[model samples]
Target: MADRELEEIGEDNTLLLVDDEEPFLKRLARAMEKRGFAVETAGSVAAGRAYATARPPAYAVVDLRLEDGSGLEVVETLRETRPDCRVVVLTGYGAIATAVAAVKIGAMDYLSKPADANDVTAALLAPAGDLPPPPENPMSADRVRWEHIQRVYELCDRNVSETARRLNMHRRTLQRILAKRSPR
Candidate 1:
C-alpha cells in the first residue's frame, strides 16, 4: 500500500519535517525515508522557513507550535515558494480554531500529536476533496473530555485556578480530575 502511494507521488519525493521535539522529528524523518521520501528536518520555525524558501519540498509535516514561532508561517512560506506542496499540520494542542486556520492557509490536513507514520502518510497522500477514512481506534468520549481538559490546563500555564475558572468547573473537581490518570 505504501509502495503504491510512493509510486503515485512520482519522482519528486522530497519531504520536509519541522518539529521542535528532536526525538520525534528524527523518528518521523526516518520513518518517512523508509517509506521513500527524501526527507529533510528542521527543529525551529526559522530553519523551516529558510528551507522552504531555499529549496521547497513536495510535501511537509509541520508541528503547529515551535520555540521560535508557529508552524503556520512555514506553511505560508512553502505555499508561496511552491504552491503544489502538500502540507500537514501536526499539533500537540489541537483546537478547532487552529485546525481551521491551518486549512485556510493551505494545509492539506491537520493531525493531533503522537500521530504515527502510517496516519501521516495517508494524510499526505489522500486525494484532494476526499474525506480521510475514520480512525481504526477512535478516542472514547471520556478520553476526548480528558484530552480537552489537559489542553486547557496546559494553555492556562498549568494553573489549576485559571483552568477551572476558564472551564467553569469547580476548583476541587478540576484538581481531582487532574490528579487522576487520563482515560483511554
Candidate 2:
C-alpha cells in the first residue's frame, strides 16, 4: 500500500495517535518509534483533529473513547481531509457494532487494546483484509512447564521468579522458555 496519503503529502510516514489512556500511549509510542515511525500523540479527539488539521499524518491510530470526545469524530475528519491516509481504530471495549461502524465509515481496521507492535504494524501496512501468517506452533517445550509458567506469568505480568515459585519449578526453567522466544 502507498504509505503516503497523497501525491503531494510526501513520505514522512508520520503517525497521529489518539488515546485517552496515558500508560498505553507511552508504551505504544515508544514501540512505534522503535519500529521507525514518526509519531505524534493527542489525548483527546478534538486535539487530534486540531493536530491533523495543522499537519496531516500518513497514518492514524485512534481510540474509540476519549476523555474529551468520541474518537469517531477524529476518524470521520481524517477520512474527509486525508482520504488516502490509513486509519486504524482502537477500542478498549471491543464490540462488533463499533467495529462494523468503523469499517463502514472509513477506518482500515479495528483493534482491541493491549495489542502488540506486530498487530499495529500489520494493521498499518498490510492489505486491508489480509492478516499475517500465524507463527509456527512448536511443541519442543513440554506443555506442563509452559502452562504452569503461563498461568503464573499472567498473574505476575511475565515476571520470572514469581511464576516459577507459583508453578513450583526452578526460575531457570521459566527463563529458558523466555530465552527461547527471544533472539539469540
Candidate 3:
C-alpha cells in the first residue's frame, strides 16, 4: 500500500523526521525507510532547522515540542527552502491552537504522538484538500479524556492540585482518575 502511494505521489523520496525522543525517532525513521523514503533524522530543533536549510526534503515529520524550541521553526525553514515540502507536525501534546499554527506555518498535516508509520505515510501522500479516511480504531471518549488529563498532569509537573486547578476538576476526583489505569 505504501509503495503504491509513494509511486503515485511521484515526488523525491527524501524525508526528514525530527523528534526529541530518540527511540521513537529511530523506529519511525526505520519504518519510513521500509516504506520507501530515504529518511534523515534529527533529535533537536536546531539540528532539524540546519538540515532543512541545508537540504529541504520532499517530506518531513517533526515533533512539535523540542528541548530547544518548537518544531514549527523547522517547518518554517523547510518552507523557506522548498515551498513544496510536505510537512507533518507530530506531538504528544495535541491541541487545537497548535494544530492551527502548524497548518498556518506550512505543515501539510498534524498528528498526535503514537501515530503509526502507515498513518504518517497516508498523511504524507494524500492528495491536497482531501480528507483522510477515518481511523481503523478511533480512541474511545474515555480514553481521550484520560489522555487529556495525563497530558495536563505532566504539563503541571505531576502536581495533582495544579492539574486539577487547570482542568477545573476537583482535586480528589483528579487524584482518583490519576490512580486508575488508563482507558482503552
Candidate 4:
C-alpha cells in the first residue's frame, strides 16, 4: 500500500525530524540519513514549518511541545499545505488527551519520548511500509488512558477521591476503571 502510494505520488522518500532538543534532533537526523532516508532537522516547530514549507518531506516526526508553539500546529500546517505527508508525533509529556488530539489532528501515530533509532525509524516508515504485523493492542488506547489517569492521580498525590471528583466521575467507577487494567 505504501509502495503504491509512493509510486502514485512519485515523491522522494524523505523524513522530517522536528524537536526542541537539539541533540536528539541531530542524532535522529544523522541516524535516519545513515539508514538511507533523506532527513531534515528543525530545532523548533516554527523552523520545521518553514523548512517543510520550502521543501515538503514525505513523513514527519513532531514533538508535541515546541519553543514557539505546540506540535499540533505543525500537524495542522502539514495537513493544510502538504496533505500527503504523514506526521508521527514524538512527545516526552505523553498523555491520553494529547495522543488522541494528535491523531485527531492528522498525526499518523504518537510515540513517547526517549525513542531510539528504531522507534524513530518505525514512526517514519511504518505507515508507508515496513510495518510489523498488527499487534493485539495496536495502540493500547485503554492502557494510555489508564496511564494518563494514574499520572494525573499521582500528581494529585494519590488522592483518588479528589481526582475522581475533579474528573466528575464517581470514585468507585474510577477505581473500577483503574482496577480492571491494573499492571501486574
**Maximum-TM-score candidate:** 1
Candidate 4 per-residue lDDT, tens place, 71-154, comes to 888788888879978788987667778989998888878787667776666665564554444433333566556667876786
**Top-scoring candidate (lDDT):** 1
Residues 74-129, candidate 2, lDDT per residue (tens digit)? 98888878888889998755567788999888999888655676688778887757
Q: Which residue pairs in candidate 3 collide? A: none
lDDT score for residue 65 of model 3:
89
Summing lDDT over every window of 10 consecutive residues in candidate 2, give the lowest-scoring window: 1-10
Error of 2 at 53 (Å): 1.2
Please give each candidate's TM-score: 0.91, 0.65, 0.89, 0.65
Worst 10 residues of 1 by lDDT: 1-10
Summed over model 3, clashes come to 0
Per-residue lDDT of 117 in model 4: 71
Q: Write the per-residue lDDT of candidate 3 for residues 26-138, one digit (tens) a residue.
A: 99999888888999999999999999999889999999989888899999999999999999999877788899999999898998877999899989988899998888877
What would the C-alpha RMSD of candidate 1 be, to one decimal place?
Answer: 1.7
> Candidate 4: TM-score?
0.65
Error of 1 at 108 (Å): 0.6
95 Cα displacement, candidate 3 (Å): 2.0
Check candidate 4 and list the clashing pairs: none
Model 4 clash tally, residue pairs: 0
- Per-residue CA lDDT of model 1 for 68-112, tens digit only, reads 889999999999999999999999777899999999999999998
Query: lDDT of each model, Cα atoms only?
Result: 0.93, 0.77, 0.90, 0.76
Error of 1 at 18 (Å): 1.0
